[model samples]
Target: MGADPTAIVVGLGLPSDVGTGWLDDLTDGFRDECDLVGAGVAGGDTTRCDLVVISVTALGDLGGRAPVTRSGARPGDVVAVAGRLGHAAAGLALLESGHEGLPGPDGRRRDDPRRDDPRRDGRAEPYGSDERREDGVAGLVGAHRRPRPPYPCGPQAAALGATAMLDVSDGLLQDLGHVARASGVGIALDPGAFTVTPEMERVARLLAADPLDWVLTGGEDHALAATFPAEVRLPPAWTVVGRVTGGEGVQVSGRTVGQGGWDHFRM
Candidate 1:
């Protein structure tokens, strides 16, 4: 729903060996982010555990407006997204690939002999500072470290008469499936509509992965996706990606796509 967050309550489970300094740093991070949104840490509980565990409950205010819900989407509504899409996933891929350890223009930390040789088994490996800057891999890494969801856009969508709204914490397709199911309407996405950054494209090339896969199926970007009336003039932050139809399920360019995304239980 499109609501403004007001407060957060944290539940922390930490091992007994953890130091006070570590705890302070953890709490400080939460406070810093909450302060950015004018929210505060209301209260929380802590306990000893085998591993660190965290649970957060966020409270929000809808102002005087009715909450925008997934069930409100109807046929003919325009589906749009605000904020990023695949940056986090691409960043994670870079980290997982051990690219962060490569030296030189890559900005990776480690010094490897391979850095001078550049070739493993006669295959050309892509590396260099100019390419890194142009692709903006560093920025992608930062995006993963701290996802910047368009918080204010939530209320903006609500004010603009968004029929259905949700933050795309999971993959876009999976989260949109929730709206499709709840509203009993179908959503058809345009493959050409999504914006894939150069950094994402570069990462995909290095990994031999489709950038669209990251955009459509990768999770944790936390971009806001909403459905608005066709007549609504969305702000510059929102990009129209799809449309609602009089059916059930989500599709892209006339083909049905799987609702594959982050599932905490499955994980």
Candidate 2:
């Protein structure tokens, strides 16, 4: 007997890089959950193979569990997320602009001050070090190229009596809008609650972009966004970014937030 064809098809359709090493990582990552099911890669022609194609499928037993879907959200739930934001967007900006280091506060320089310069006070500046900037840039680049999803977070939310859940593939505002529309509710996000990490703030400054915009508008984060009871004890990793209301749409700071999700057509 061989692996099931349906399983192979499903695996290939999973949301990850197709031919890249990411596929292997994904396979290995899910090794314990279900058997690989099936996998195949094909490439080549009589002359030269210009393209590679891979097909995979996966199948799993429910183990007597209920299924979940996008329409399960409800009003009065506390909206939360598990994962970092804006790193990928900041990384893409750095890569496109050919910037070598992470973004930083205005007027800061990488090298230490020269001691003997007449214009210098000869005092060491107490700003961030080079290592911190480098780490920030590297993290942003990794986020852009490959986002790590909180796979366990979703299951944990369900187990913790969550009313709804979703993956943040679009901008935070846009994904929240989906939940709001689905649950027949509205959402309000606190701008102050969303903090930009140091590296992201630097990148935003370098690009002359607003750090808040980057945090709200960035997509491809792959973080798990979920809604739980207002009184529920949220996990430490989860951040309570917003709240669901009984209204019909979504808002940020009392203003109607726009939907700017991933749209290949618009691009």
Candidate 3:
């Protein structure tokens, strides 16, 4: 299909385990939900074509709204995120352990309230302890293979009086530093203010890693990091992790958080 200059862009890829029918299903799903710009596959004549490549580009109109860049965050604006975080990182651990299911140390399955229906309960139970571990592995695998951006959060921030915004591609602390540097401000994140979920804390305990560090330093959560006016009412999905201050760097409880994001050359 031809591209639409006035529509937003959406991208999709075929999973490694995905068959042709699954790819078709994904494409059809995208068409039903979004105005896709273009879709196709790419390859080269090599002895080993180990990966299937798919790329998509989306063009969107802002309807005359001013674009909110990282430079606009100011002191007193609340810093927040509007989607899931750290699950993929937790999942990666499970996959690396070669677990087939999600089970806690005691053998009780971690209940996911999102699956409240009784009929769906059967399917949800298997996703417990070991199953959860497996899902976590699958999640991290998916995250490494493909990243799903919270596109709406960007536009939503703009619509909801967000002063500044950026996607959380890197670790939260690192990305917030970007916002801070760009806006010529400092951020003070409150670890006490953070409410770690059970699954996340459990994963952290199981991995023997600090849950706070995972939330602070582990990246690829893809949640939206935005700065809103102090008085603005944020949605429930949003978490108040830190605050913007009048300065030039970022800090966690007054201590400077180092810039430790992904760097190919350094690695």
Candidate 4:
């Protein structure tokens, strides 16, 4: 749905061993992010737990506009996306390959990677040994840690008569599957429509991975995917990827894809 966020409520389950400085930094980061979208922290609750847990709820106003739902998509509508496609997933791959917090060419933390890698056992070697590779790796890693969602585009899409809309939080294929199932229609995507950034190509080459896999199945970028009438003139920020069809489920390049997205239960 297209709405303006106004406030956020947080709930923290922190460990007893955590330091006050750590709490201060966490709150400060929250404030900084909220400020970017003109939202404020309306207060929250905290409790002791064995591990750190954060829960956030955002409140928004639709400004008299009707809420866009996944079920509203219709056949012949064009499918488009606003913002990035697979930067976050590529970043996560770098972290898993043990390339977090690696210094840049200037020996600065400008390319620091954090938040996704868990194999911090000092056993994995860095992937980027040269300046060019290091810069590309850092850019991809930054995307994972600091995903910037296209906030304003949500409302703009709705204003342009979007029939269905959703954020690509759980992979493009997975999230769009929800829309397709809900709308009782099929979504046919064009793989060539997605751009394979140079950074992504470089990292994938080094890691022996497929860059297109990241674009199709990687999640957490928070890009907006919406369906609109074919005649609608979309803004430059939006890229047309596919179209809604008369059947059910989602396909890529006219063929059905396998299950390859993030699934908490499967993980």
Per-candidate Cα lDDT values, in order, are 0.78, 0.59, 0.60, 0.79
Distance from true position, residue 56, model 4, in Å?
Answer: 0.3
Candidate 4 residue-wise lDDT, 24-142, digit = tens: 76787677667767889998899999999999998888999999999999999999999778888988897898755554446666433342321222222222222233245586776
Give the range of the ten consecutive residues with the poorest summed lDDT in model 3. Answer: 120-129
Q: 1 or 4, which is superior by lDDT? A: 4
Which is the winner by TM-score between candidate 2 and candidate 3? 3
* Total backbone clashes of candidate 3, pairs 3 or more residues apart or in separate chains: 13
Off-target runs (Cα >4 Å) in candidate 4 are: 100-135, 258-267
- Candidates arranged by lDDT, highest first: 4, 1, 3, 2
- Top lDDT model: 4
What TM-score does candidate 1 get on C-alpha atoms?
Answer: 0.84
Error of 4 at 31 (Å): 0.8
lDDT of 3 by residue, 81-189 (tens): 7665665555556456554245655675544422222222222122112224334333443443333444455666677888888777677778888889889998887
The per-prediction tally of clashing pairs is 0, 11, 13, 0
lDDT of 2 by residue, 134-209 (tens): 3455657656755555555655777677777777777777777787777778887777777588777767777886
Pairs of colliding residues, candidate 4: none
Residues 74-177, candidate 1, lDDT per residue (tens digit)? 99999999988988888778778877543324566543323322122233222222233323666566566656677789888999999999888888988999
RMSD to truth, every model = 8.7, 11.7, 8.1, 7.1
